[model samples]
Target: MTMQHPAFAKGHVAVVTGAASGIGLAAAREFARLGLCVVLADLEGDRLEAACQEVRALAAGGEADVVAIATDVSRPDQVESLERAVIQRFGRVHILMNNAGIQPGSSLFGPQANWDSVLAVNLMGVIYGTRTFGPNMMSHKDPALIINTGSKQGITTPPGDPAYNVSKAGVKAFTEALQHELRNTQGCRVTAHLLIPGFVYTALTANGRTEKPAGAWTPEQTVEFMMRSIERGDFYILCPDNDVDRATDERRIAWAAGDIIENRPPLSRWHPDHADAARDFIAKRD
Candidate 1:
């Protein structure tokens, strides 16, 4: 399971939030396989321990290396404690991945709890992780990276799940600012990135389903794409799932942005009145 990837070099240390499952766990395994001492952080205690074991099994050079910390990323204190523990154990963190997220269904008129919970985890979690680990990494001369997981829903502003979309949208805005600041800071070696995943078959998107839908991409595939994008120095890693190709994604994104420029009904692409026009626009692009 050892991956000989150039994105993460040997002897480096990485801290990945939401490492208990899904894309976070998959990315953590890849980092460990590449000879980096990885720290897995997640809220699920049992799942975090099990994920650590899996990552340990993939260690290229023996000694059972890896640590699992139960952390609630929503709380600043917990995230700060996780950083302290990582530094205490591993010395320095070269990679920080704020991948913890929750997909609570909601609409414009949804309960305040749903909005609060989603924002606390998806948005503030990323903010806290960056604010805590980023400064120390910047002080070090070693090259480092911080990846925040966002969602396509945030960009397109599609129908349904408005709360989830809003939180992720905040992530997009915050990470963009973070990257800009990192690039401008003198002697800083860390860079920030936003990961926008399409329909991925993860626990968050499973919705109680036992089987994976054909339209969804597996965690492995998503991480592979992420690594490739990172190697290209991509700030926005927009991933494509099984049902959506790059071209289709581009068209959708363009149309979404065009909604403001064209002054069409909000989300008019989905509106019955604009269905024909939307299809025509896509057809012309194709």
Candidate 2:
């Protein structure tokens, strides 16, 4: 299907981090298929090379249109180098998908290593990528997109995986602020979007499972939804999987906000004292 977003025009350059697999790889392939030059960034390894080949096969211009860069987005220097490399090869970039992220398991007081690594890659990576490439994108004065991958846990702040939740929550907040700044800036055409994906069966979420879960979405499905949302100019591209629909997601998010508004305990949806009340609230329709 043809994309409606102006920035998706053919010949435009699109950079996708974490493109070695999952949602990031899916998005990179789609861009290549759409005739845009694609840059796939991930840690240097067989996966990155293989992903580059996968995307290259779909690229209209073949090998010349697709390249892979080994980038540790958590490092500002690497992120800056990624920008320079892209510019040197492609001249200009029109679309940036800051989708590099890691979700190692974490406890509330987990090993400092887990927390640090998660935050550095998941949150700081997005920050470094945006700051490094955003200025030139704006200077181009062409329709462009800055898509930051977020998560549902960021919005609802679920109990498990506190480090993951905190990192994604920061992504949500930072992308929001970035969008606001982009919109208010004079003569700026670059737009920021937060891509909040549902349970997608990726390497990151495999958790040793050999087969795809019935309730999860494939990365392609998630990317298709994301493109449609971007075409519609949606800032919060909240995706639904096989198990949960948009209505249910909306209710859950509202209830999360209600915790503060109603003066209830944090994450009251899981709190013993508020379980029944939260269930009843979610059950009611508008």
Candidate 3:
């Protein structure tokens, strides 16, 4: 597994948001294993400390460095502070993973707080993190990577949890525009990537469950998949878990596109009238 970018090499730095656990922590650990200096930020202080320790342990004795910060990604000042602190410590940042997210339940007429919280953290956090770190990365001579964590729901626009879907959809659009912008900018070496993860066994998705369901991939597995995707220079790093394959995901996304192209109802796959048809569509072997 050779590193595709210098960011993955020793002495470079990688910052991961929501790194206290799950995919973020797994990414940080993997970076440490690659000997990159890793900085972790999360809203949970104690868990962030534990994660920092875990990343430290992953390194061969004195092989890499880890920094931890208690950060609320939704706030601009906090995210800015995180960037400044990382720069102050490591001198430069070569990789930025805006992976912070929250999933409080929401509905069509749910409490206003749910929607507000979801948008602020899930959408605005990625926006702010990208804005803060992107320019600095572009200024440097090193090749840089920016990975914004998106969701499959963003593309498919599922029926349940409208707020979550909306937020992730924003991420998808923003990352697309970001990659385009970077590509057109002269002397810009930074590449933007959208990581659409499949069902992963993480705290946000656990819903108080003690065991990982069969369909879910571990956080480490997800990050490993992400690395491979990055190496391929893929803009949309869509992941498939145990329950779904790439072909299934492709069919589902094409059907979602058909909702507008073919004049079907929005999110028709989940609608009652379209259930059988959607099932039949999914059942197609080809």
Candidate 4:
């Protein structure tokens, strides 16, 4: 599919973290197919190398235009090294996808290590990638992008996994602030986008399931929706899955915010007192 965004132009450079699998791999594949010099950054291993080869096969310029850098985005030093390596190889980067994340099932009183790892990879990773690469991308004077992957749980602040919710919420807030800064920076052509995926059938979401659930979307479908949103100049690329549509997502988010506005109990949708009201509000139309 041809991309309409100037940032996706042929021969441009795109760096996608977590490119070894799922949405990151899907985005890298699309970029390579569009003739962009694609850099796949992930942990050092055979899986990363294999993903690089898959992207390379679809690259318009073949192997030369596709490279994989062993990177642990959670480490600031490693993320910095990734930026330097990409710059040295490609000279300039037109797209940066800070898409590395992890959700190892967190509880309110879970091991602190779980919280630490989740925040390190899901939130700080995005900050490191954007801050490390933003200046270089702006200096090139070309339309560029920084896409941060977030989650719906962040918006709604659901129960069951507090650490993952907190991490993704930080991503959403950080990406918003980053975009505001980019738009206000003089002579800067780079833009930031928040990609909120819903029920994507990835290794991160599979939870040992061999087959995708009926309600989940494939990584390719989510990436395709993200590209379309970017082409339309949307900052919040909120995606829908087989079980939900845009309208449902909107209502759910609104109900979440209304908890504060109406002075209701937190997560009132799940609270027995407000359950009927929440259901009716979501089912109602304007």
Order of the predicted models by TM-score, top scorer first:
2, 4, 3, 1
Clashing pairs in 1: none
What would you estimate as the lDDT of candidate 2? 0.95
Q: Write the per-residue lDDT of candidate 2 for residues 1-286, one digit (tens) a residue.
A: 6558989999999999999999999999999989999999999999999999999999989999999999999899999999999999999999999999998899987699999999999999999999999999999898999999999999999888999999999999999999999999999999999999999999999999989999999999999999999988899999999999998899999999999998999999999999998899888888
Residue 29, candidate 2: Cα error in Å is: 0.7
RMSD for each of the candidates: 2.4, 1.2, 1.5, 1.3
lDDT tens digits, residues 1-286, model 1?
A: 3443343888788899999999999999999888999889998678888898899888774344588889999999999999999999888889999999988788788799999999999999999999999889888778899999998888988888898888999999999999999999988878888999989999988989999999999999999999888887889899999898887888888888888999998898899999788878766753
Q: Estimate each model's TM-score.
A: 0.95, 0.98, 0.96, 0.98
Q: What's the best-to-worst order under lDDT?
A: 2, 4, 3, 1
Q: What local distance difference test score does each model get? A: 0.89, 0.95, 0.90, 0.95
Worst 10 residues of 3 by lDDT: 58-67
lDDT of 3 by residue, 92-146 (tens): 8999999999999789898999999999999999999999999999999688999
